[model samples]
Target: MSTSAPASLTGRTVLVANPSADLYGSDRMMLEAVRGLLKQNSRVIATCSRTGPLVDRLQELGVTVHITEVPVIRKSMLSPRGMLNLARIVMSTFPRMRRLIGAARADIVIANTLTLPFWTLAARSCRRPIIVYVHEAESSLSRAARTLLTAPLGLADGVVFNSETSRIACKAQALERRGKVRVVLNGVQGPATSRPPRDHIEGPARLLFVGRLSPRKGPDLIIDAAALLRSMGIAVTVDLVGDVFPGYEWYEDQLRARVRELHLEGVVRFRGFQSPVWEAIDGADMMIVPSRGDESFGNVVIESLLSARPVIVADHTGLREAASGFESAVRVAPDDPKAVADAVRRVLEDWGHFRAVAMVEAVVAQARLGTDRFHEGFGRAVEELDR
Candidate 1:
């Protein structure tokens, strides 16, 4: 701890480093935190993202912006080509960040994910302690980056995980002997309170799967679940709202063929890469998170609850803790269509009781699910670290 901290963080700047502009869940959370902090009179300067929905939103919020490219070359560093490209990105990004950090002269530096620990290390020269926020657990990394994340993650003055599941998983990987971690649930801020109530049409429930359209998202299991329901003569339709992960386009195509082979022409809809998926949630009745990977937290869970709906999340090592007491949520075996179909039957058969439970949960969650709540939670964590 230092004897001096930046005063109040009002006019004092805070630099947030974003690794990529993928328009994913954690990216959105990072943008919201910046916007909320600004409302309290903080100035935010984001680095290495010139494009994405977040950069546009930050400009609209009146924050100072420095845009540059931190190209993520998704390949092995050991490759003859990969090393050359990575070295270029690192060299290019280093100068841009040094310029951004110098111009911003930030009160604090915020690492939006483990991807930007280099930014945290850069902040050391400026004497700004870093706040590390983890939204997803570790991945099987290139040999070098994994070693780098451990030490910086341990020394970060503040660490915030989006869910208890994520916090525990992150601790299990990198923080068990390190320090305290905070759980800051992702928030939803919008004007839905005055809207018309959802009408779950009696024909077939419209289910949505809203993560990457890869095998990791377990779309295969959801399709199998649909097949199981068809076997029982129950009606259900699903719309998948994600794009295939890079290099997995063939797998996505294979799943489509499986749907066709099963004669599920009208049962499954692949709605690809929907922007502002909150609208899709508005139209649908239930959301499913079938990820087989370690999911740190999910924003779709909050969106479904905001729409006064519920979810069926897969239970597995990287993701199971989400089934804890949300009444509206049920956890079944990951990648098991039998368990998935059973959970769906439970929801459809008891929709009324489930809605009542979710309605009350919605009222209680209003405060926690807003942008302000996340800002307050994160701000408190940083201030505590300063003291």
Candidate 2:
């Protein structure tokens, strides 16, 4: 009962302004969007703040890459000095962005995330149709802070919320009323075939936590949960996959120190960030997404489900939205190591039942949250802007 994707954009050009060049959840989503546009014969020009693997991939795909400094709004940039720096970056890059859009004769512009508010304004000044892709659901933020972040979406011709949670958190009801909003739940592709969950729960249970190693993502919580599980005579080895941001090295250090403090030296391993995380997910019996803060949607949770792996997620925001209705998925209280431990314990006790359920859910997830759906939804968003 779904409508077809819009017609081809043969003669149109798209300019995608993304905040980072890293291959994280949002960054990977951006890549898929670019691919979808190319399939429709739209010329794509991508702009990244810094150079990384994503930029390389774009060029390899024959998409023009424009390296520029993109002003990203973060919690650290809320102070006077931070605000001043943001202002300076805006002053320097705004005109250049507008000029790039005009020079490329871009018919449409897409700001990959709300972090790049400057891109929205630049596209507006260029008189190009712009779509803002909202990826974060900051229910934890103060109302004013949320407003400041979402204010630039006013200039966008269309707003694409990755999930309904994101739309509500951004207070985009007004935009929805104007028919400028589309909630396109992320479409993620897993391995070519679903990997079955481990047959036998022998030795220690393999637990995997994948995401940015930040306080909000709660890598520390995984360590605590592992410690608790071990204390209860449960043999478990925890693998913390993913890395920290440039300035958040301290968080990683704190995690290692906590592991040492808990004397979980050999039990806990830091795998850093792994691209194409299928092998890691396949190796683990279960995956955990313990975000202590707001998430627009749970790409990792979907990945785990698609891999036929049971997932233990913090029950709130998009995590709940993603993990709900699947028997293989377990929800625990956010920021509570005991809750995580208990959930893991329960799953271990009934491993056979959970694994069977995971195999079934993998097929359902593939049909519902697969890459094809994502590409079609992304195409529809652009087509709506064309109207």
Candidate 3:
């Protein structure tokens, strides 16, 4: 790729490769980035391994969609049988992926996650400018996984990271110091106005957790915290509003069993995945993000702030960065149920003050993470490819 300005994106075609079709944090962020590209009058062709609501939603946005067998290499897929199956999928898909790139005649290729290094390989074959948008933090990856993931990053023309935390991690492990790296903080469509105020705070406090039900996300930690609060004579209701990932059904079963063991049937409720998650955030008095692993960026934390709800998040990796500027956010040690319960108690102890602070923080967060800023950063990253 030449480092001189070539052309504008007004008529340029872009191919976006996403690892999964499910609408989680990274998927939603990818959608937002695609929307930004469309606004620039660029033509887009998006690819995913499977069909889901995200694929349908992309089509609705006027982007051409390709459903391919782009198998993601995860830690779980490192076993002997798993590795064999992965190799078969990759071998079968590689040629087809290269053909798709050629057929699309894409001027730019954007691999939207670290898990899809194969997309980088295919894009290289097509001689298109490759930009890898990394959404995972380093602390989350094992040493072997880090090496495996970073190995192909040298092929990228430009790298987009969602946060400074992720940028530092990637540079330290995968990327060259001179690599073209851009830190584009993820943005959300801020709520029109602060959510309606709660009528009373003297009753049972409602807490919300809205992400995947996995060990990394620490949903079980929330349940344990709820039990602890109950034991201390505090009436609290915890609403878990996300489903377990595919192949993680056993984790959900474990969570349910733990809930039963703790006799917290009434205190904790599993309200599977909810769309327009703001509605769920609005219904709760506070939002909790008890992640036990590294998060590249916590979109849910900003969403809660935008909804004028106080947040209690695990103080780790990019999570600390996400909750940094908001006075309404309380940070607790990761995987510490007692710390979670204590933070919750502190927020509720002075509920009125915290509510007011949350409203103010919402205003600050909106200005920092507005759609215009996100679009500008995204546009600049793409435009850099032509230079």
> Please, what is the whole-model Cα lDDT of each candidate in the order they appear?
0.70, 0.88, 0.86
Candidate 2 per-residue lDDT, tens place, 1-387, comes to 354435547768899988999999899999989887886778899999888989988998999999888778997676557777888879987888888898888989999998998888888887888899889898887776777778888888989889989988888766788888888889897797655787989999999999999999998988999999988999999999899999999999999999999999999999998988998998899999999999989999999999999999999999999987888889999999999999999999999999999999999999999888888778877788668
Candidate 2 structure lDDT: 0.88
Question: What TM value does model 3 have?
Answer: 0.94
> TM-scores across all candidates?
0.85, 0.96, 0.94
1-387, model 3: which lDDT tens digit per residue?
A: 223322588889999999888888999988999988887778999999888889988999998999988888787764557766877779988998999899999989999988898899899988888999899886666676676667678888888899998887775344446547788999988766556548457678999999999998999999999999998889999999999988999999999999999998888999999877877887799999999888989999999988889999999888899999788999998889999999999998888889889988888888898666787678777787556
Candidate 1 on 195-278: residue-level lDDT in tens?
Answer: 323545588887888878877678888898899998988888988888886689998898899999888888899888876777
Question: After best superposition, candidate 2 residue 160: deviation in angstroms?
Answer: 0.4
**lDDT-better candidate, 2 vs 3:** 2
Error of 3 at 120 (Å): 0.5
lDDT of 1 at 49: 55
Model number with the top TM-score: 2
